[model samples]
Target: MKKTGIAGFLLSVCLLLAGCTSQNVDTTPVWQQTLPQTGVQMEVSNCTLENSGPVYYAMDRVDTDYWTEKTAVQVEGVPVVTLYGVDPEEVELRFVENVSYLYIYYDKVMPQPDLDYVLTETNDGALQYRLDTVYNYEFVITTEQGTDSMMVICHRDSLESANTGTT
Candidate 1:
């Protein structure tokens, strides 16, 4: 009985040592060593829901540098552009603009919640201008839930007009 007990104890020790051994080694940095130097091509999608004005665009795995450049132009001279529901440390913002529209991009460190309050409050209401133009633009939140990428669009002009009580 004593010999059997000793054998069991030895087996347990061996199992514990085996468990401690690293099974899969990953030496790569947690964040990519180098993000894409150029802007990533984004796919634009129309909002499916009715009355959700303006087309939407998105790209998964976009590099940090790309987002930075895009947001730089979008937020120029814009006061109080706040990014919420995301870890401030792990993300970067980019502002960009063309003849057509302004674009804001975010390089998120983790999947974060969408800023729904901003969306609901500003959509198709008095606050539309505040979300449309650069004068009062906002960071539209994006998130991954299950297999879908949830996005919110900011209509700067509407938001602005609503705030100032201008028709």
Candidate 2:
């Protein structure tokens, strides 16, 4: 009886240790854990226009605030373009083309059913989701030499400032 009890105790301990150690071993590959396409890129021109539109002002404000609070750098001159978006659960932004345009992209993880429903309803065969809930604005500055464009993307809260009616 004594021998049987000792063996059972040892077996239980071995099983417990095995269970604990198994969790520490990672079998997934490094590439599987990270996305290949992630991050932001930007380019902007140095030339400034006498008439900067609302879009330009908003972009500049966002750039200044982002850099000051996040990057800890005092950037000189205003950004012509800004892009904000997600890439596989990571948020990234890029300002590009001599600050001529801002391109934003982001990765979002929504429920598969909800995403499917949204896509089916908004697809319109264009593969672009119809943005019904967001407010968008564009400001263009035409110069003798060329044209400069500014775009503003905001949620409903910011739309009140523009005096656009929302339901």
Q: How many times do residue backbones clash in model 1?
A: 29
For each candidate, the alpha-carbon lDDT, in order, equals 0.28, 0.27
Residues 1-167, candidate 2, lDDT per residue (tens digit)?
99999999999999997885343312121111111133232122221222222232223424533421111111112212222222222221222111232322111222232221121111222111112223233323333334333333323332321112332
**Cα error, candidate 1, residue 150 (Å):** 11
| Segments in model 2 whose C-alpha atoms lie over 4 Å from true places | 1-54, 57-62, 65-117, 120-125, 136-167
Full-model lDDT, candidate 2: 0.27
**TM-score against native, each model:** 0.21, 0.18
- Alpha-carbon error at 23 in model 2, in Å? 49
Model 1 TM-score relative to the real fold: 0.21
User: Pairing residues by index, what is the TM-score of model 2?
Assistant: 0.18
* Clashing residue pair totals per candidate (backbone < 3 A): 29, 22
